[model samples]
Target chain A: MRIELAYFAWVRERMGTPGETVELPPAIADVAALLGWLAARDERGAATFADPHRIRAAIDGALAGPDAPLAGVREVALFPPVTGG
Target chain B: MIRVFVQAAPIDVGAEIDLHDAGGHGASASFIGRVRGDAGLTELFLEHHPAMTEAGLASLAHAAADRWKLGALTLIHRVGSMTPGETIVLVLASSRHRAEALAACEYLIDRLKTDVMLWKRESFADGRIAWVEEREDDRDRAARWE
Candidate 1:
């Protein structure tokens, strides 16, 4: 599957890009799996994906949990906890 | 009535208040959030998912309306670069009574703290830029509503 990823705030700074599209294998089933796959992909993702619990995910656009299924999502955003009011 | 606005410009309180349809309400309560100049904070850069942020707020406004029997509600949040004392967000609620209006306004702003997916990066006076952390207290506060 091909998924579009978006990074915001420190996640974007650490990843060095706001977003990218990547092809994934069938084994990557959820947001956590995607993070693990990203961490092993290369140096750019090493530190960013180091702590999966510290990051949040949004499937397509709405906020989702770490266990959120990614089967139909074309876009995923990873970022730190929101601090706005 | 529900009004949700997400923009990069500063919020105009007077204009926003004037724009609200206040026809059937006897009380209108508002909460304005402004950038803090304390702790050597110089600037704040806000980032949000365009479509999602608006949708998120609309849902929140709906929740507020349902909970408080709101006659009118307005929610606006600003993004991009902002300086200290600039308006960051505004929540206004109108009801037939002061208690409902005030409580709903509080609920809207309080709920926004944790539930809304908006991030902030701070630029300090010494040229240090840092992402603001989500406070446990905020989560605790949001949990109170649950």
Candidate 2:
């Protein structure tokens, strides 16, 4: 499936880009699998996605969890925890 | 009514209040977050996943509405670089009584601190910059609503 990956804050800084569209392998089942798959794609991903526990996600536009399915979704966001008033 | 704004413009506090202050609600409460100049802070850079941020704020508004019998609620958070004395965020809530308005306004601000997708990078006057971390205090505050 094809999906747009978005990074925000420090996650974007470490990734060297804000967002990108990429085609993925079919075996990637959910958000957790997608994170692991992307992290193995390159060194940058490996370094930034080193800790899944520290990472948070939003599937499409709603805050999602590890079990969120990526099927038929257009966008996925990854970032650190929020720190705003 | 739920209104969420994530923008680069300054929050017009009075105008925002007037937009929803159509009587009936006997009590209204607001919270403004400003850049603290006294903390050796020079600038604050706010970043977020655009669509998700708004959606998150709307969800927070909905949650607040559900928790309390809110008549009108507004959440406005600014993005981009901001200096000292600038408004960073605003949470305005109104209800027929003071207790609900106060509690809901406080709840919205407290939940927003940890639940939203916004992130802050602080730049000191000495040229040092750092990403603000999630605080234990914020988490504890949010948990109180449970």
Candidate 3:
């Protein structure tokens, strides 16, 4: 399935890009699997997803977890914990 | 109803709240975040991807409306270059009672800081740019609401 991926703050800095649209392999079943797939794609992806504990994910616009299903999601955002006020 | 505005100009939080409440609000609360010159920094520059920023703010407004009994809500966040003492963001909530308005205003600010997708870069006097990290206290504050 095709999905839109967005990066924010330091995550965008490390990734060197803000957002992208990509097609996922069938094996990429959930958020965690998608992260692993992305990491395997290149060194930058690996580095970005290196510390999942510090990273936050949002499926569509709502906060989500790594194990959350991405079956119908059109977008997934990955970024450091939010800090804005 | 909730209104969200993100601009590069100065934000007058008090005036905005007053205007919002002029219609017939009994209670109103607001939060104004300013650039702290004491961050060992000379100036601050904020950048955001336009579409994403709007989407993020819209989502935050929706959350606040769903969580509180609000009569009017407004959030204004500035971007681009800003000096010390300048406002960064403003959150205003109007309700029938002070408790609900206060809680909603706090909730809006807290969630905006912790969940929104805006980015700020601090430039030190020595010529360095750094991304602000998520504060531990912000996380704790957000947790209390959950």
Chain B TM-score list for all models: 0.97, 0.95, 0.90
Residue-by-residue lDDT tens digits, candidate 2, A1-85: 8999999888888899999998999999798998898789999899888888888988878889999988999889889988988
Q: Candidate 2, after superposition: displacement of residue B45 in Å? A: 1.2
Model 1 chain A: weakest 10-residue lDDT segment is A57-66
Best by TM-score: 1
lDDT of each: 0.90, 0.87, 0.81
Model 1: per-residue Cα lDDT over B1-146, one tens digit each:
89999999889999999998878799999999999999899999999886888888899999999999999999999999999999999998999999999998877787888877799999998999899999998888888788
DockQ of 2: 0.80
Model 2, residue A30: distance off in Å is 2.1
TM-score of chain A of each: 0.95, 0.96, 0.92
Worst 10 residues of 2 chain B by lDDT: B17-26
DockQ of every candidate: 0.83, 0.80, 0.52
Point out the higher-scoring one by DockQ: 2 or 3.
2
TM-score of chain A of 1: 0.95
Clashing pairs in 3: A84-B113
TM-score of chain A of 3: 0.92
The residue-level lDDT of candidate 1 at A1 comes to 95
Which structure among the candidates has the greatest DockQ? 1
Under CAPRI classification, how is model 1 graded?
high
Q: What TM-score does candidate 2 reach? A: 0.91
DockQ of 1: 0.83
Which 10-residue span in candidate 1 chain B carries the lowest summed lDDT?
A: B108-117
Q: Give each model a TM-score.
A: 0.97, 0.91, 0.83
